[model samples]
Target: MTSTPHHQPILDSPYVLDLFAGPGGLDVAAHVLDVPSLGIEWDRSACLTRYAAGLDTLHADVSAIRREAFESLPPEINVLAGGPPCQTYSVAGSGVGRKALDEVKGYIERLMAGDSDEKIDKELQKLSDPRTALVLEPLRYAIQATRSPNRGHRPYDVIVLEQVPAVQALWAHYALVLKNIGLPDGTKYQVKVGVLDTETYGVPQTRSRAVLIARRVGLGEPFLPEPTHQAYEAKGWNRGNGEAAALTHQPSLDEEITPEPVTRRGKSGGPLPWVSMRMALPGRRKPFLVRSNYGSSGHPGRRGVRTDQQPAATVTGRISRFVVFEHLDENVVYEGPRFSMNEAGMLQSFPPAYPWSGTAQAQQVGNAVPPLFGAHLLSAALGLPVPDPEALREPWVPATEEERAKLRSQGCGAADDCTARCPRPEDQAPPRSVSQKKKLSAG
Candidate 1:
């Protein structure tokens, strides 16, 4: 928690409600930006996890929270956002009964609301319809139940949802719901969904998340953000392309490799320079990927630290640092690079001082929503003013070799330590010790 101008505990600033707010990542981003947020999580332990972050949260099943209650919030909400539990819809978790989704596949399949009307109302109607429209997938119905801004309910100026790309059909559902409700304050809105890399936003991890930015009429037309850094493109450097070496520090493929396709600043036309791994995580070049063999197959950190110059993958719950980059041989000595929970939090966009409670796996991964991705969408919706890119991405440096040596001296990386690895999210230990080594580093 941070102090305000008067030194009071600063809980949140952007003012959002994290419905199904698993460990409050969405809320964390809004709060880091000084946006006040109110998060709700159905899982009792999950709610306590948000409380640990100093956030005000309601621990209730989202389904049970009447839409009328959410509508009662202040009408001028800056943003209404959440990453509803996506596991049920995710291919990884959907069971055979998820066939309920197949019945409504057409609604999900309909990508375009036809551009005939404004995207907002269409989104609303799509959600409110009983036909099980997949436009918003499973979550749309919940969103529509809330009163519209016009109805004196908790009217939102913007809405943001984070999830995997498989939920694109859900995006269409939201558009239709907004259309059904018509634009609030006569402020029309446009919705856009894109794949965002945390590294681009300055986090060392290469986590990719689906981002949706909805801009209200007065704010200005929706726009994609521009990239602030460049990853080294090896092909250009080797081909004698002017300034290829200067473009990025990431080692290129054969000195002539092309970089990941990206819009400059998350743009549509040009690719933005990628943030480098060493530049991103600073000292994590050789750490072992540790885990407890439970969540995420046991990657030991949030936004698991990226190396080999690749983009960091999305940080997820049920991940354990004890699992990453481990040798397969049962008898091999376990000396190698590994990430501390603090390192994982840095990659996930949490402030260094951000207190994560609960078990190690639950606390770190649960509280973060990649700040880079959060800023990416907000900037687009508000026609973002110029930002100090450095300020937004407080870069993270790994612990020095000496620090790692000490962790190794302890029980870490030993085959014996690996034997007792806990599988439950709440039963894990800190990478070596739980003390985080840094303060907040990303926007």
Candidate 2:
């Protein structure tokens, strides 16, 4: 695992160093904002995807970088961002981290008390899963950054971290620690931590993540990004009044499903409607219904259904198990298509032709922070203007026949197989219509 130069040069200022950077999710957002970033990821598959996406990546463990190479980071890198491994903390996975919360807090206290790395490492090994200890890596990096100014290493001015909603308590503890640890310049950090809904930020999927944003007190106060889209409310179910009703019946395959009316507004009075699956992946000839493999409300056999009219349910590594079918009358039942890798990526707000590589790409896409959401988060964290929701939802043109042929000639089967020469969404002409956009599938 080593560093490789990307097609684009790393910028000289406001650079980001991303830890546990799986498949360049935040990196994509940084690139869109013209902020250069270097991601440190240990997974070979994810690193391969990062290289394919033209994202600068150091293919190594975050712990290794923090310990053996912290001082080697470029002085221009002033932003620290990461989404640590969340499997242990995710509700969908084993609850080891949740059960071990107090122990983790103890480690945080020990670290703040100046415990030696060796002593912490010895205790961390005692966890049921060693990855549980990785969650503290970001805190370790933050603490190191605060103390490094005397050694010629510039302390990170902006720190952003995210994980499963289960980590909100951990982030709360982080806020307290960061505020007390004054920078060498005698300025403490302004910290904010909370849970954010991805759909509220215009991501097409309904996912919740715990986020922490910190900045030096001399900089502007830290605050969470405001919601730019209305939060999603699943049709036919009312949690507010404890009322339940059957979902509206499916329309015929040829009939279009009208979008639900939305009049919600934010403080800016400009928040848009929650983005739907149909809006996110337009150009389908037939209306489709997605049947989730997993059940809801303790019904192990009851698969959940989401109409094209709504935002997709939280995408998981097992998204391949989800089946998509043509919307038909209730009397009929048949096998339907599963979402293609590209379709899944788009549902997660990746560009139509984003170069996903290696195996477990669905997992990679599922684990990633939606780049669209990342853009808004980063914009707020950096005190930049938020990106327009309409602009973010603008459809991307699929690869042209000529582009596909050129890729084929280069011995590439798909855009993801190409590297530096991969065609970018901005490089292509906009499609004349949504139907025309589907002319060339990334599949």
Candidate 3:
């Protein structure tokens, strides 16, 4: 589906082409920065959410649609960004594992051997695994975009990619390959890849992801965005403040972080306190406790109990299972209240009142890149000015009375004394039944 923008797009702004756009997380950031963009997505649920949010989208399989599909875009593409579906590569997923990885590498090698698409398709069919190879689709587009600059085409100026940290090795390999290809101008791309902690970028969640950035030749050295927020665990590993080190908030190990007013905004003494649940879900008061659904199991660890004082653990699609816990002397109970979709969206830095549609609201939120962090990556890719996080506020909720009421309804309680337990059992997905087995896919 080739859909046009629901809103007028700025024709002069740098254009961002997003692949596997999910629910338009990166596009949200692009919009905030006034960068016109179009997302290519295939998932029906995610596309509905994107459309509801008024994002321009083209619904199609990235692998099947090829570069010819993007000919309508400006000749000189400014930015290329994508987060390929990561089912087979996620540590949480059980799939073809390392074997699938090797098969993908073999497939790429054969393609380089001048193997025809029909032959490759048949061979991939025999392997019975496709998602592992899907990760290379972005690379395919990049190569095609820059292949004929001499023939009146302009290569994309910047490229950005992200995936689970487990896929870091794959990205590093791509970085090397991208560095070797000369564009029409005889300059190669400068590439860099590393694991980025979302908390360090003000995402309000401690999700670590593999990030890759590449700038076309002549744009100076490629570099990752510097961390804009202080990490809670900084005291353990970062000890000294050398001259060359970028400034970061490093609390003393003995220092204590008490809960501040949820309304309190702006930085106090150091980099803005790593965003916490309190700031993201202001309705939930102190001593906040979380409980998992029916059959959750895990060793005692700081996984389940999310306090307003700390950033949340990585949010997964199974978030509904985790709820607020009420403790009273010897009795512990959960009264069926769970974190709302709005709260989850805030944790992911999505705009307030984001029109999240479809039954997979939680899944869409879980899969998106945090918009605040995404803005940082985009800025780095385009060598643009970094956006002030404070200036980027959610458009609704807490601010909107009607939305605030909805958020309150989903919370356990608003009492200051109501807090979740610390270190509750981790909520792992139940094992899939034989009937649940299907081809792998990514968000």
Q: What are the Cα lDDT values of the candidates?
A: 0.45, 0.69, 0.63
TM-score list, all predictions: 0.57, 0.77, 0.73
lDDT score, candidate 1, position 166: 54
lDDT of 1 by residue, 1-443 (tens): 01111212111234465565666666655544556666655444454445555555655445334333445444445566766444335545434224434434433333222232234335535432222232232233223423355444433556677765555555555555444444322334566666554565555454545666665444434444544445332233323332223234334323433223322355654445565433445444332223233322122332222233543444555433434442223323244655455556655655444445455553446445766566655545444442333443443333344543432233123312221211233322223211343332321
| Poorly placed runs, candidate 1 (over 4 Å) | 1-14, 91-154, 176-188, 217-219, 230-273, 280-311, 321-334, 360-368, 386-443
Checking candidate 3 for backbone clashes, the offending pairs are 85-442, 287-419, 287-420, 288-419, 288-420, 289-419, 289-420, 289-421
Clashes of 2: 0
Q: Supply the global lDDT for candidate 3.
A: 0.63
Error of 3 at 122 (Å): 4.5
Sort by lDDT, top down from the best: 2, 3, 1
Cα RMSD to the true fold for all candidates? 15.1, 12.1, 12.6
**Can you write out model 3's per-residue Cα lDDT over 101-187, one digit (the tens) per residue?**
666666554444445556766666554445666787776666556444542556677889998887887777777656763432344
In model 3, where is the ten-residue run with the lowest total lDDT?
1-10
**Candidate 2 Cα deviation (angstroms), residue 200:** 1.0
